[model samples]
Target: MYFPFRQLLASSLALTALTIPARAQISIGEPIPFTDTFSGTLLDDTFLVLTAWRTDTGSVNGGLFGRTFVGLTNEPVGEATVSAQSSTTAPNFFMARNSASLSVENAEAARYTTQSSHGTHTQVEFFTPTSLTPARTRFHWNVSGLTSSTYPGVVTNADLRFAAGYFPTTSYYDFFDLATQENGGPLMSVSGTGAFSYNLPLLLNQPIDLFYHTVAYVGFTAEGGETFSGFSDFSNTHILDRIELFDSNDVLISEWGMREISSGQVMFDQNGRTAAANGGNNIPEPGTLGLLALGGAALLGRVCRRTKKGN
Candidate 1:
């Protein structure tokens, strides 16, 4: 069953307010990199698993409205389940299981619209133990599995976004579109099973507090006949095999492979303070602002649609 939008929002806000600083897990001064291979039974303490959703229900002419945001650490909320699961394909890996089903019937109006989405985000927030700036940095991750399916009358798509940076507010917690190069690192998408990396922008002469954020999302939408139904299932998908961090000289600084996750040495903070301390103007690499601008445009489109419906 789905939680009420207002209730979900209230619960998320309360959780955000109660979150405390994460313990120090990684020290930048060391040359050795930290890594986890997921060989353990449980997910390491270095990562925070979060589940969220955005559901819109309304007539086609009236436009879909209502959005609920839920951010829970290491728990399932709505149709999304964030956990560490094992399977034949992937013996040990981080998985985000999600499914959604909805139907709309408007016999008199002869119009109907249905939209549902579920997302799971794994975030690792950390701060530099000492003042140390690198010439460049690289964030790498491996995806082991991904799957998506949708029933007739419905169109579905699965998207993945990876980002890193200092996000100090609760507003940016579960929303992937809000991740821009300024407050967070540039958003990068992964299509299928494989490895990916991002060349992070340089931050000079400041105490650094950062978060590596990755989310797997599946959405289903349908609009047509007076009576229609849609169902989607995305399970055992978006599995992470390993995540590694490298410094300017290409030296591995930290890694989480799931094996030694506890000893992986990557800090996991829920509430970060770097942005507030640095005046909230941490700039991104040149030429990457356009990516976020496009995201903003998409968001604006949704707002415009709602405005037209008098919502």
Candidate 2:
């Protein structure tokens, strides 16, 4: 039977959709493992931190760290009180007030080899998803100053670890691992029906602010690399952001950087997405960041100049 051209097209289009892969609807739910932020308060063994997880095993640093307390550990025994340091109960807005770190001198023999080297995550905790069915969980984090991080030496196998506990014991989800020693780190991600994981790397030796606006849930993910960065340093600021793991301690390193134990959120898609977002997140341009890095040019002098339409 003959039918109208427009109707025939509509019928054909509807049939085509039947063959396409189906998409599932999802959304973010309340945090599962943590409700409030604190210096230490984690379920032992569930929250894991390594002084040098995979950066590079050495004679100086190595071993897994479990954070089941409320403050820094491995601190040297009693000694004369020097000056002092300052940390805040509330983190400065849009900045990483929470901090963590490890030292080679205080670390035990490498967890991997005889000469181990690495640092532990400050707030190590175990996490599992119970909100949505299953999909790649999105990660959103922020940093304030160079003091967010510190590294006086080098590391070899630093990586962003993405894992999963999975519902009904789903498949292994460790595909979101990558070597994070390159420029601006890695700005990428992955997703699928079963699970998802993504990471944003930090730029070395620079002060920068960052944010994540998208919702791509990573079922169960954790961020910590190298266990330790060898000669590394981390603190809330000059006074608080420190890891004194030595008997003869001296605050020789500090930078405006990021937290060793980053604050992350797991989000899901409300409208649902068939694929993942693959875009270059951020890599400061030489003209813009270069000037800021040196403090040679006024903040707006060069960037504000623009030609008005038609002279």
Candidate 3:
């Protein structure tokens, strides 16, 4: 019995040496998708979708501080497009001195239009395409166009944008504050900043055949930007760079965007190399795959040795 136990332990150690780990990339049939083949899917290589929507101290005339969405697609994401904009302002307490909200103007894939020119403003909607494959998706909010003279609350630029993840069943907060000219309601006062997020979840195919919703809270604040309300010399615009999506592993799965700040409305750019473009399928590096295979073989060898000893 002692001899058999000793032989089993030896086999176990040998098996451990032969075992190899699996890569993070999804199999062809898996439901999730990748936006970019981030760092070739190494265990430590994670991906993130980045977009900027406003600049605090930069010129606003060139870019509109635009807003747009990235439709979710389970299939290998093909042709993709990115769009952003900046808008003119109107004078009003609802538009300025709000400090909590930014000026609102422009609309796309939405029915609401801009009724105010200079006060607080915003665009709200889910980025998830009405028809697309469902997975746990995350939307990245990128913001710019702020400074200590313009935004004082933040110590770093990365803290400017707001990232909110929402499920499917989440309810929308009405903008009644701006509507009724009251600060206590939904729409708050206007600041020099813009806010955005995509918290809605798309449909997923699974055992329950039920929906998996990921609702999120989206928007941004002026922090402590210079007050332009009740004054004409004060003016500003929020410019967004792009909206990005990621998978459960925190890997940047795919994105639909562009780098040109002054470019026209968002359109498909073939130059992007996000994972969605690669169909979330990538070849595992030989070094790592080889290690995993070796580990598996070692495990099998150990089991075989133990069986032989028992016999």
Candidate 4:
């Protein structure tokens, strides 16, 4: 379930000083699998933040960047309305799930400024509480979605974008604008079912955060006052049927199922027992990375704006 940023921040800060014990080095051919099928009524509590925003603007610095917080109360099924600068142009963006999958979409089209632009951005993140330093790692997942834009008039730019990947560290400045190096080399291109396995160049002992992000953007100059509409439609849906992780020899190192994630039992190892269960060790709590990243982005934006003004 989703927790408020304030509550999550407080808890994360309190646990910041705690240390996470490194897992025993997983050897090849040892089964230590981790898998997750979205069969639960709620997203795993390890998902610390869910956020979305829409913007309409006449100038780069003059857009109304409306932001919204998605709560766990509506999980397994819910939608939030993204308001545009104009009163008549509200669009509904939803993040819903059933016993089988999680879906994200913006059903209604957003209206763009007659001679400017409009866009929507959504992101969700999952925190890894433990440190995994396996010599070799394999990652796999599934997805199906589409984005479209309709401009009854003239247009200069239009596009829909989606990206999924993980951060090696718990801290980040921007979720949507992460540099390639920040996401562990290259970001995963999420479309159909895909998987990749690679050997580590060095031992990694810190926890990582997995993230999924999407953007629907359009820029146009209306002709004869004709309006423009655009959206990211995934009605067919994106399903995380299963996410499995394995070591070099294809042995399971750790696994997560919908039930375990939904219930916040995210700190488990190969034997299906949490660190606490193995002994008294506790996984390091994650900070409010989502909010912190957004704040950093805003600050960076302001800095860039001031520099532009100076020029």
Candidate 5:
């Protein structure tokens, strides 16, 4: 009788460990509140605020970000890019958000595994037309869920990747640009998965806006330099409950939206399609944005012509 009771208790504990929520879904039009957990000088006043999480479900997890440059010029600035500066400039656009949680749970004293995942994401709201004096101006935006995140269980390291340009096949793909400092050096690269910051030399006198996204990847080997694999053996897993963004003073400025991601959701597919929409996501072009910009231009042109006739 004693042996049977012990076995039942052990089985119950094992089942509880195996069953966990991997993904969290929320309503699209809902209003999520942001609380200030940091107080200090910011990188910029404008921020791409967010929150993040981890779950017991998937192999590949991801978040989404969006922006609009409405009422700006239609001329392409080529690909949109981001620049990071210690100080803000006239017409300068910047994202002031930072990560909150950086460490995983202590497994030595605990029973389960631990891990972490993150990277910054920015989408161009708009670019200033070459025809415009400032070149690039104006921006509108939103961030992907969970700007920061972590998960641990047989996983040792995390990797962050950015998309300089991601679009739907229904339209031509336009490259969105981002600026970042890698290994303590400043350089810009086109936005896409692989490595490094992708936006620079593009932030002079431009009022820009940014959006960010983050994802957590779990590794199997306890050692570093592990290979990427699909979600076939996540029966034993760890969860990230909260994600935060910190400032220079080490304060939490923003927290990410956290949820367990369903498995096999590759952030960037072989053909450049994001797993978020399976291949249905779209990016807009300068010309398509021109129609909206043209409305204001038409009014200005008419005003200039009228003044000439009166003179």
Candidate 6:
């Protein structure tokens, strides 16, 4: 009996080891399509946002601060919109559009600031369950149609830009660091294809602790101005069709996307990962726990036989 039980226990342990799935690149699929990926319309849900309209903050120019949507849609407020904007501020949203176009044409008239000569166009922060590594994770985004005249009387130095702390940085809050902005980071742009792309390859693979990290967030401010006068009216249009995350194998791990679905409400996505991305059991996994119990039973049976023989 002893010999058989020992053999059985060893076999069970071997089986458990075999069953554990090897670690691979985490690939979480797109769970939901925002009623309008944050167009912030009547149908939109699960967003944490604060907006102002026709109001001027007199904030520091080229800095992201004052009345920005700092906590805009995150996982905590899933399926319900959490927002505060001026009552008079009409919602600048439309039904979900295919392939994002981030040019002046699609530029939201309601910007971070309403001050004419100085303003911030747009700002968004994305904090996800998974933090991307410079080596293992690569980002792919597309841009189509760059037009400067979309905004009336504004076409000088008109450019479409994103926050520099976007991909490499983990904290959504770092975007507001005045010093970081002072670096005059290069603007968001693509090669001159009818539609261009933003694809950067890292020099070394820098990995951050998973889940505890921040996704990137940046503000887009197109300051269209003249040499003598400061930025007057700002205007630029761009269509951002896709934002994809890939692995070394060139497989898509996640996607921040633009799409339309049929019936069901979209699931919550923190950045590219799902709301449940950052979670784990402190104890052994379920299968391992069960195997441990079976081993204990086998050991008890062996002890019972020895006691009976002594009696």
Judged by TM-score, which candidate is best?
1
User: Candidate 4 on 31-139: residue-level lDDT in tens?
Assistant: 1111101111111122222322211111111211222222222222123222221111112121111111112233222212111111222222223333543433333
lDDT of 2 at 254: 23
Residue-pair clash count for candidate 3: 69
* Model 1, C-alpha of 79: deviation from truth (Å): 25
Which window of ten consecutive residues has the lowest lDDT sum in model 2?
A: 1-10
Root-mean-square deviation of candidate 6: 26.2
Shift in Å, residue 89, candidate 3: 5.4
lDDT of 3 by residue, 1-311 (tens): 00110000112222212212322111221111101000000001111111111111111112122221111112121121112111233121111110111221221121110001111111122233323323443333322343321222211111111222222221111111123114322222222334644343432321111111110111112212222111111123232224444455544444333211111222222233333322221221122232332322221122101111210
lDDT of 5 by residue, 1-311 (tens): 00000000011111111222223212221011100011111111112211111121111111112211111112221222111111100111222222121222221122111112222222222222233322211112222213221323322222222232222111100111223344433212221122222332224322221222222222222123222221111112111112222333443333221111233233222222233423332221111222232222121111100011110
Best by lDDT: 1
Model 6 poorest 10 in a row by lDDT? 1-10
Give model 4 RMSD, 1 decimal: 15.5
lDDT of 1 by residue, 100-213 (tens): 333333322221212222222223323344333334555545544334333442232333455544333323223344534545436565444566766655454332333222
Each model's lDDT comes to: 0.28, 0.18, 0.20, 0.25, 0.20, 0.22
Q: How many residue pairs clash in model 5?
A: 41
State in Å the error of residue 29, model 5.
12
Which is the better candidate, 2 or 4, if ranked by TM-score?
4
The weakest ten consecutive residues by lDDT in model 3 span 34-43
**Candidate 6 residue-wise lDDT, 1-311, digit = tens:** 01000001112212222132322111221111111011111111111222221111111111121112222221222222222211111111110111111122223222221111111122122222445532233333322222222333322222222332223332211222223223544234222223433443323322211110001111123232211111211112222333444556665546332111211112123153222212211111222233333332221121101011110
| Cα-lDDT of candidate 4 | 0.25
- Model 2, residue 76: displacement in angstroms? 11
Looking at model 4, which ten-residue stretch has the lowest summed lDDT? 302-311
The TM-scores, one per candidate, come to 0.39, 0.21, 0.22, 0.35, 0.20, 0.24
State the number of backbone clashes in model 1: 13
Q: How many residue pairs clash in each candidate?
A: 13, 57, 69, 12, 41, 17
